[model samples]
Target: MRNLWNLIVQYHIALVFLILQGIALTWFVGSHGYPRGKWVQRSLEWQGKWDQRMSQWDRLTELDDLNRELLAENATLRAELHTARRDGVQSTYQGAEVIRSTWNGASNPFVLNKGTAQGVKPGLGLLQNNRVVGRVVEVSENYALALPLINKSMEWSVRIGPTGPVARLVWEGGDVTRAMVYDVPRSASFAPGDSVVSSGFQGYFPSGLLIGKVADETPEFDGQFLTVPVTLAADFRAIRYVEIATVQGRMELDSLANSNGQQAP
Candidate 1:
């Protein structure tokens, strides 16, 4: 401690000079209006940058929430569109999300988050993005199973062209992007770009809903019907949201079939 005091005493003159220099520097800075203003300006600039970054962060969070809501809203609109396709077909529509799905198997099916509790039942048609997706085949309280169009046993009554006559739609079971339309009359001239739509025979899916577009026309082995290639509209691998349609006439039709012990013609 004594040695430290002695060293300070030896440097006291130099220290006083340093102290006077610091005071002078402080006075000089305080005397200048521009210097003071510059310091304040720098502080404000830093604050503004911080605020901008925080605001952008808040917007990013809000945008994510908005996107989810929009997806659900779009699902509802898809159901409404199916209802509008036919006048006399009494049906109810509701939106749902896919819980499980498989396209690589012979019997590709989809599982949804809604079921009998949500008014989903067997024979109800499933749709996504206003296009035909599948038909519900099994149901539980909170979940349901659907037979997608890509399934081998999956068949739908479809038309060759937009206003053309009825034909049967089936998946060829090889390429996921393509399917086959059978029983199309050879007399009807349809090309690759022609649209194929539903025929409303099942009363579940309304008539005139787009299924796909004709990809190619091939002469079937039977020669009686033209088996044409179709490019499916829905990409099964990317399916997310779906909607279920409740058809009114289906219950009555089911009753009649049960009473007669035979299916409807």
Candidate 2:
């Protein structure tokens, strides 16, 4: 008790000043109505602002998770919208996050963080934003593999923009920057910037999904076909998230083509 008294004595003047200031503030707030009340209100307002700022700082840490969830929800809604427009026959789509990617000439495929648990299945069309990215080739209980359009063996039917001819879009194996569009009529008027889109003739993809833009066009010797170069819409090298399109009648179309020995345009 004596040591405590000596320590208080060392700062007695400071302690007295603090106590007097507190008493004065209380008296001013209690007795003075307008001016002191306004000051107190303003001080409380400042404290409230600080508290709000701290709350926002805490919420900032969840921004990424919020964005991802929003993206997934948006994809689901878009798929539902498409299904509605198709008279409820088109299969619903689901979103998936890419977990692994490989592109060393052994087939370019991506491993996604979705599988049967998420309604993901093999043969489902994969897309990014609004463009076709690939198709699901394999699926497990927890994950799936996607064969991206950049792979040398990948091919899809696509139509040129606004009445232009339809053709097969395929990667040429060596050039990653471009793909070859086959069977375009040499007489078809095409420019370097014409847009290409999914034909949806085979039911593997939705009509109007962007394929690429024409990069160049070369006429064959017989002047019957054009060797068209196309730049893909999806980067493939930097895809982070994707959606899988569950086509409802894709199997029927595939069986028909196999039986007839004909391909869809």
Instruction: Please list the Cα RMSD from the true structure of every candidate, rounded to 1 decimal place.
Output: 25.3, 23.8
Clashing pairs in 1: none
Q: What lDDT, from 0 to 1, does candidate 2 have?
A: 0.72
TM-score of 2: 0.68
lDDT of 1 by residue, 44-138 (tens): 34543454355445446776457447767876665566467656665566777675667787666666767677777678887776688888776
Expressed as tens digits, the lDDT of each residue in 137-214 for candidate 2 is: 766656676788777656788888856777888886665667888898867787788888888775667777888898
Q: What is the C-alpha local distance difference test score of each model?
A: 0.72, 0.72
lDDT of 1: 0.72
- In candidate 1, residue 13 scores what lDDT? 99
